[model samples]
Target chain A: MTHKKNTKAIKLVTMIMLTSVAQAQVTINQKLTASIYSDNKNGVEGDDGYKLIEERLEIRGNGQNIEAYARIDLTKFIDAPSSDYRDDERLERLLTSYHLGDWRIDIGDIHLEMGRGIALSLKPIESAGVDTALRGGQMAYQSKKIEFNIFGGEANPANLDTLSQKHVVDTPDRIIGIRGQIQANKALPTIGIFGIYLKPDDQKLNELLNAEKEDQNITTGITIQAREILNTFDIYIEGDYQKRRLIDQEETGKAIYSTIDLTIKETIILIEGIYLNGFEQRGSPHTATDTRVSYNRPPTLERIDQEVLETRDILGGRIRLERPIISEDYVGHINGMYRIQSPDSEEEITQIHGYAGLEIYLPDKLAFSGGYRDERYSGGALKGEKLKSMIHGEGDLTVGLEGYELHAQSTNELRRRPSDGDSGGEKRYARGSTLLGLERGGRMGLTLEYGYDTEKEGVRQHFFAGIAHWKFLEGQKLRLAAGTQRGGVKCIAGICREYPAFAGARFEWLGHF
Target chain B: MKYTLLAALLLSLSAPQSRADERPLAPEIKGKSTQDELINVADYKGKTTIILFWATWCAPCKKAIPEFIKIQEEIGEDKIQIIAINMDDAQTRSRVKSTIKRNKWKMPIILDTDGTIAKKINSTNSAPYTVVIDKQGKIAYSEEGYTSDNAEKWAERLKKLSTEP
Candidate 1:
């Protein structure tokens, strides 16, 4: 199909879907955000004096046993189109589903994730820019003991932003998958098996700079998973085998992941492990790792940057324990992990990390917490070899008064590394922050943070003012904040993203109709 | 950035539509619990019930569960019941089971891996969603998100709901 024709068809379908959804009793949730940045120095790379706006609209409705949802996002730069503007403004997601007696059918962008996302996952990772929406249809059947799912369609292009910027690609890659599970007997474990096949189309026009064409392969994989929850323990295991073939090269990958959680009284112990051989992890490269033929990642693997997934051969395990130290009010935790990785045609890297922490809760008035961490990494290539052995030790303390209304925290870190060429020394860092407001006394407050690095003799300071109103105007939640801070990694849940230094303002308002 | 003004205008046009009369009856949901037993929501029709849709990976859900537990304790089981419907997919089922057990929540929980029940209630695609059903089997309140002090508000609402004829 021609590009213009395809675009017109998509627009027509979108409008029809929107009109149908708007007629129903629907609720529209809208978010509008604008950020202004100004940085004189080059300290904050890729960010200059500019303004960016992001607009999001989500509509949801249910009628006649069918549910519908749509999200439209538009992002634009002020004045002129920034280099990145080409990647802005796209129909993010559209979905409609209906259920029959024992069967369900879903069409349009499907963002489904299966068993820990090992074999096939249509889950989008925003930070990593890993896209996984299938613009297709799914059929599912459920019974007392057996369930089946079959889906086929084009997977959202891996490089959505790049494709948006260029807009020359004709067809997205095709994806087909089938999954089934059987209870068989209630006394036995529930077992599931899934298989997926993917074939990239027209790679010549849709070239990606960061990805190697050799990496583009017709990939297929199958996964088997089992789960059993004993009286005191919960155990899960999954094994995956994938095969990829290019015109010249063919490779097979295998991975095994498992987790066991044992609960005894008030204490919890968890053991998780992963082993990979020639498995190039799949997700979004923007997501802190590599991308592969299949959209699968050992979602339970723990590492700083998914570094373990970067290697061709990898093995890792982690253990964590939580228990009461002395009484019901005091709790302690200990965790440790070790990993070894060998990147394809590269040197092997080994890492070991551990941490211990304790928290004491005082009856509704005050609380205190302290923690210690030790991290070490070694091995790699020449320049990376000099990057060789590096060790980091850190400690933190936090005290809260009146249930965190008045809170203060301090963190200190010491790092030791082998001298590169001439510089042979250790680095020390100390950081502190204070939060001054709770919901009761003040609707607005101030936050102050400072960080000092001894080796670089750099001092970073940030001051933020925030205000939150729960019942603003008409039962709306409005939160506003303005701040200036240094660039660093921001983490939510276990996902982390590195952001540039910024001085900006943020406003949020949430209301439902 | 000119779209900012357009977005703001769109936001201003939204009118607060009354929703109490439009809510459909709760779907009949029956699922296996982490304890390996069947739990049916319809069985609790005679008592005020709060069904909180949650997941183990959601930070807010983790925060809200403990508070819901406290609220359940204050309201007492006879006056009201709180059921947590887990929305984690099958891959994370084990994690969900372990997390609930470790927290020692006293409320009954149902595993809804397919999310059929949650979809019937509301399709916001998130955790920490809450629905309060009155003793007469009508939805009194349904909220899509959570705040720090929502538990106190829920307790107040439950107390008021318990007194309703």
Candidate 2:
């Protein structure tokens, strides 16, 4: 019955959007991506080789007081054995925004962000290939001094699992959100209060052995932002209190994320802190695996490449200082952090990390940036503990050659792989990707890529790939890439995702009308 | 799926093949600059504007922004303008102010904390993504990723747009 209702609603929205497009100016865009790769050749990869294709189309229409949007996705697998992946087609997203005086109404998909996301953040994370939205409507009122927003709907997640090349678990949770903000004016700071409530589908939660239904799953927070308050300092503070039940047990969570910045001329000094104690929320319903889905992604207060596990019961902060080099396009920074975290059962672990780096840019578009980091982990109830460190750099060099340009872009990570057990020694490896290409008019290019490595799969392996691209028509690109790239653990916004290795050829075309 | 794609392609072909300057105005947007000031893109209607989306962790962005600043200076504010939009999420939100200050940027840096502007403009969501708006507030052109090759063409295009009525 719900499926039928959704279909009917989708048809209605589509009709409305089509009507709007015919009446108002429209922007049409689409992306077509197809790949053929070797999989399941060995352990943990896949069962076999296959070919797959996906297409996404988006259309937007704007009128005097109304805006309409529609997006659809289609994916297919060809000549493949029975496997985890599946072929499907569906309307991915639809949104209609209507404006009336100082009030606005949004129906279909809604994106919400409260403060620094300690209470709620429903959007997209490109690195994780995650884009979750509230499939409902929102009402917002805005004026010179105040803003209010409220919305409720089912939390819908992107169905495609890029890493697994399969459909994600299709379970959604009901959610409601409310927010009110006071615009900062004069010497006063801007303040806001926000809340998000979630209730998982009982049947889906029952599929998990130890899960339980809850009366209410809510997270509420307040934020205070003071910019240039002291002629040199800017401060942002947010606190959240969560009341949720996922496991058979009942528990609550709390989190606080704050940052203070001292800005002077071309230098900035920052002090940041993060305190999260059981601050977890249900994401994409009850999935047996991948449980670190806290809708409120607290800041990690660490580097994006920091190799560390995230903990709900985490307490830590970092201090960073950055400055420019005298009117030139050069920058430098230093940072340090310390944290104590636990896995809800084990003893708390202590971690300390520090890093520094410099970036250089030339007038001719040649640039280089490099950094070094050292992180130590100990004091936990573990068998092996040690310090982790790495050096990373990335840049591009462009040179003009007789009627053409020769360009090279690369990113590198050289790190010390810590020992797995108490007795094993450490191993060192360099994993960085480089692309070298030559272009005639910046419209067409052929490139070769190599040197990126991975070893977590028990062996040190290297990767190589090649690409050919052409920019045709007004705004269109056709790109083809073939390579074997090993995947590993990558973190974004304090959450981590593991990607499986890939050996394949892929084709993509992006266009806008 | 094939039929759907075919239909989409046909629809694209039927779209009015007009110049980007003839396109409708860039979606009206409002955001807060890193320096704690509210700004609306609509305010830039009479001037040629360049909207560039970037992130702190994007390597190419580090290379592209300096040149963009240089372009803004050379073209002069009376003719062309550049408004940067930072696309960092909460995990990296704290870096925006420091990053901007460290670069000594005088241009307003719009912070897209919630991605509303990106969604409204149909952003590619890639770092170094850039769009050009003509004096009439119409979207003239856009490009994804940054390279030395694109910079030369983009600068030329900006100059061309600045010369228009």
Candidate 3:
């Protein structure tokens, strides 16, 4: 009961439940964004003139059912801070919530998920601007089938030098959790339970692994989940066990995840599995399972791509198939995966992945799609052990006339190795893009784009103009872009992120309020 | 990596030609309407509204809802109102009210379901976005996507917002 008296009794019960959820009703909303980045060949810090000026402000407030939020970020580089006063490179986020009666309380920075987030989660992957929010305290409850959640926190401590030295170094160490659920509505099927506690801060793991340890380790875990089943086959399963006590050392770990879904008459099938052992593969896979939260890393199969064997000592399986080919405006898809990794213990690695897709609809205004992917790797850390392969292909097309709109896209890749000197000398890449648009009735639009990349033998051109005039404002938007861009992976619901390459001018102005 | 699509289309044609002629009001938009009534867009104060938003799995909001129902039947609703909205999702709100009542679309339709007034006007991440106001309610223009040359620039900006003032 001493960790500075339990952090001053959780900050005096979060300042008396946020001062009784701040009386009455009040409102305030704000959003502002500004971005500018200059000529940077090959990005994510490849350093070439590399200019960037980003600003963001978000403010929210509501009272009555209580709500409060804050976000501020500002950064300037390469022309070194001349947007005249950016309050010295800012960075902040805050939140508060309250709702009494069936309970729901939160205090400062928290974004949580429990059942399927394995044990805990604070999602946000925004192309790698990973924000794992949690400077926390939370409590939730619901009736009519019972539910519960409890939290205590510390995370959100990455300051990548807050736009270069605005401060924040290492501050990791604290987490507490509780999750519960039970339902009897759909004639019983849901059940969940979770418990977590962690306390490690060997100086924030020696400032992210520069090494330095003297035990402080605590770590503990437990989870169990069971989801709907028999409603035309819908079953989800989870199990975890953990224990770590290292002042003198002691460890125990386990993990397993499962999913099965089926819906016939119009296809839909999914089967998934994951297994882990030992030191729960360094636990903390951003606990809060049921996957989803990879603004930039931390997604272990949900639309599988195990990010290179997520946390090693593995065993994975996946099979997914979706349907509606021919009639439902054409559609067909498939996915497959297999994994058996060990990370290290001398030879024991295997991975395989496959994907297939098709979508086609044509009746007055064309549309088409195509896909293929295959990957394989063998033998742990293969030095001379051979066996590696990769193949990918993609295609898309769209055309709609009468006011004009056309689109085209393509992708290709191949890779193989017998030490890259055999197996038909593989290794190839391709990229393509094309867009042409013209609009006038819905208030204006003009577009032209052409992009290409045979792996960097660049070529890009884009011109876009849009207008929906009200002029003075309502929610202003003006976007302008100039040239060379090639950076992949972007997803906004299925989470993915990774966007880097850029070359030259880009402008965007959006307003609401 | 040298850019030259005619100098980036002449610098995006000089960034939208600088507009900005007085704007501010807008930002309140209450919901329901596809007969569930309870509309409330500042009670259409003195006309000229627009709104739009849309979503039916967006293909430019299904090609911009019949060009905003042919500019709300050639600007009439007592001189401009439009509305539309419908950011779909209540499991597709009865297939978007049976596809806007089988495309009869008499123009005023609301329903932002759970996106609380399109996240209170932030337009919940694009979907054929649109907004316009001016009948002295300020907020004049906004657009996101949908082009066939934007319906005669939204009817010459609603015929100069019906001759402003």
Candidates in descending DockQ order: 2, 1, 3
Interface RMSD of 1: 5.8
Query: Residues A384-437, candidate 1, lDDT per residue (tens digit)?
Result: 433323233333332323423443444444444454455665444433334444
Per-residue error for A484 in candidate 2, Å, reads: 1.2
Better of 1 and 2 by TM-score: 2
Candidate lDDT scores, in order, read 0.56, 0.73, 0.51
In order of appearance, the predictions have TM-scores of: 0.77, 0.89, 0.28
* TM-score attained by model 2: 0.89
Best of the candidates, TM-score: 2
Candidate 2 CAPRI grade: acceptable
DockQ of candidate 3 is 0.06
**lDDT score, candidate 2:** 0.73
Fnat: each model in turn:
0.04, 0.36, 0.13
Model 2: per-residue lDDT, tens digit, A1-513? 563465458547754755555454677778899988676223663434888898888777776667777778788998654555778887777787777766888888777788877777886875676677778889998665678899988766667776666676555567888998886575788888988888765444545564555445788999888888768899999888988766555679988889999977767899999888888765654242355345666677877655556657788889988776654566677788887776344565666666666665554446665666655544455524545667788777766565566778887888885767765799777777788988766578888877556545544377777888898876788999888765666666665777666678989998887
Q: Give each prediction's DockQ, rounded to 2 decimals.
A: 0.23, 0.43, 0.06
Candidate 2's error at A363, in angstroms? 2.5
Better of 2 and 3 by lDDT: 2
Local error of candidate 3 at A59, Å? 15
DockQ of 2: 0.43
- What pairs collide in candidate 2? A40-A46
